[model samples]
Target: MIIKRKVNKEVYMYSIGIDIGTTNCKLCVFELLSLKLIDSYSFATPKINSKYGYDFDIEALYSQLEQGLIQTINSLSYAEKVKNIVIASVGESGVLINQEGEVVGPCITWYDTRTQKNLADINQKFSDEELYSITGIPIHSNYSLTKILWIRENCNINLQQVKWLCIAEYIAYKLTNQKRAECSLASRTLAYDLKNHCWSEKIQSAFAINHLFADFTQSGKNIEVLTSTISTKLNCNQPIFVAIGGHDHMCGSIAAELKPGEILNSTGTTEGLLLLLEKVNFNKSFLTSQLSFGKYVKDDLYTLYASLPSAGYSIEWFKRTFSVTDENFDLLIESLLNKLDDINYIKNSLNIFIPHLRGSGPPKRNIDSKGLWYGLGENSTLADILLSIFQGLCFELKNTLITIEQLTVTHHPIIKVIGAAAKNPLWLQLKADILGREILSCNIKEAVCKGGVMLAGYENHYLDKNAHIQFDNPIARYIPNPKMTEYYHQIFADYYQPFFEFKTSLEFKLKKDN
Candidate 1:
């Protein structure tokens, strides 16, 4: 993406990017012209264990955000000026606040299954077909609407009296006193009317959630300028403009310049494959595929998105749980690829690993499913298991991409990968071999934050859109190894495919009997 360069704009005019992730929250300051990183700070997201699952400590979250902002701004030279600040975050979690902007209830996370009962109640009222048709989200508790309903009922809060703001929106409100929902994030809520591009009247009225959210706006829409209190709090002399940055993946897609027949594989704690399209597809084929459809960062465009909730989290969980060291698991399996021609050896050595650690996504979206590994021998080493985890995540991604191809009826040759996936060469190669698609490692460090910066730059006439979309070069490329790709095709069809079906059934029976 092109950097902002105009004068009236000095060398020190900068933009701030606030990315509130599930695991790590970051604040980055970038030079609007060079797009050089000036300063950055990071902290863990504050989450507390609730009776049902986990709830975000809002006060703690804001405190950490405030600290990062102050540290980034104060470190600048006196000549520097701040232009715009934008926020991006997870789409599924938010906080409820009273009229005075004080948090009123617990902010439960999207993965918390405590809202299953609330979802079932809604399912009883509307058919799954109708629900998905209206919201473009499958019937799942991971969306904001289910969690909002859970808080409203469990906390005994009056839905009509208070309002909801997603985590990013909350941060913006604290700075600028504007309570606006980004269109992309608002599209994730099950209560949003996708066709009409507004809040759903039928669903909101049925659930008594009228007047629960403020007005929705496009990403990078200039809502308001920073308040005096915030300016003084951060010790900043110049004014700061706050704009909505929308969902993390949609924001990252801006840097990728994602176009038709191209897919963006955003890997972080979670992983999602996002395909940009001129129109939305909610047909029955997509309904069964269970891929989510939502408003893109550009208000007129749309996205077909599929997620693996435990992509990177699975690696972290295995390393932490098993106390595995930072050994090179990738090298341990390189010798195995050489034996692809030996059918007998390949069959005996290959093990099945399924990463459903944070529920299952697409085709059969279920929150009850857990991860599994099969064919583990008594002598299985930690390194061997780690290799399996990496291979498992690649296979899981392939499974979703197959459904995406069948539904969209489009085949993409080169898939652009950003975020954590770009940093890991082994993961990218494995994904290329498994999917038989070339993987381009678009390694712009903190690309999502860069997206926020770019949006703010363009909104303020500091950037050129045509020039910014020219970041079409990949830092690295991973082409599929033909021998390895051929071997994977057989295993994916003969073993992985059949095992996935069996495990889905097993999970269903386990949930039903319980």
Candidate 2:
């Protein structure tokens, strides 16, 4: 929904970056030489609520993507200079298509808990330890394996006859008629083997689902070109390499030049804490904590990732509940935060919110958990309620950050934040105080999409090795106030912990009863 035109007649080579996110699907054009964004377009991701859960409308999703792609290319001054198109998307959700180019099943959202029974059935056959060791993912309904199994059972489709492609790969297939899986996203599916970097024999032998998996490759590979018809439609004469961009968070990590000791706080619809590693290793703490280990977008590397199921998504829900549009979301939130400031909100909070509107993540990954709030006074104003919800989100993130530190065995000096949350000064300062850490928020917009652009340029050898360093991010640091940090620490330990534990117990009981 945003467009910016840059005219540079000297530029003859460009790269296209497509980011298929949970909330929005965006396309950006970057100069291959400088990686400067020239043009962009965005549209809402096509997902609708279903009886089973939220399912993506594959045709609608692809239609919007194609439209955005064509429009961006057509808007660029150097349309024929397009050299590479790279796709990055959220992990787990995917489409199943037949040999005749017909969609065979729904692309179920990863967070849908309808697959809980499917995962439980899987656990009876494979131990959690064995699954984690082979797949580097915990036995959770949020992973793709459970969703695929649920689809197989409900849709009653022949798994061998159709091909499975994660969201990004599906886009690649539609554009180039190529079916492949990137390493990082493939690892999100429990069917992938972490050690072998291919589809797992464990899943094949156990479930008899073999041909469903596509050919595997790393994120940086470009083995196909845009279809001739597509080329003509976009009025481009030059060949455009179609590169596979991996999971969105990992792509952001590449743009941020994230190192081993540092952490990337990627906050979008969902928020994740990612750490890079040179060696393939997992801790026993990961097994208990449910922290995910996966193949990095860059080959020969690994990632330790933990997530909060809802972050900005919660804010979006709040905005919708109040009928606030994007144009006014920030202004409204700032006004509310200021009102809170006048009342000494930090030292005296009457509400403790458990932000599980979607689900809970880490230490206890439960999709069945529901959102809950307590201590709302009869005199509570709208600002009080809003601030409570926001604080709950920060509290949940702080809990996961603490758990991630324990599993990784390092207390990072500063957290590098990417995505939309980094741009909101109110949220940044609040998070810094709650987490008791300095926040390094990247001001480079569309960082995830830029990562895709970087990969496309790097794959085509259009940029030098030091291009990541050249990103030259305008970082805004949020330092925690000493008194506020101390107060938050006490509240989290004394009040938030007990409230969260109680909600977990209550939600579990309600689920069991139903």
Q: Rate the local accuracy (lDDT) of all candidates.
A: 0.82, 0.82
TM-score of each: 0.94, 0.94
Q: What are the per-residue Cα lDDT tens digits for candidate 2 across 427-498?
A: 888788889899998866688888887776666677775644455457899998778788778889999998
Task: Please give the TM-score that candidate 2 achieves against the real structure.
Answer: 0.94
Off by over 4 Å in 1: 1-9, 78-80, 325-349, 468-474
Clashing pairs in 2: none
Quality of model 2 by C-alpha lDDT: 0.82
As a whole number from 0 to 100, the lDDT of residue 331 in candidate 2 is: 66
Scored against the true structure, residue 297 in model 1 reaches a CA lDDT of: 82
Per-candidate Cα RMSD to the true structure, in Å, reads 3.4, 3.4
Number of clashing residue pairs in every model?
0, 0
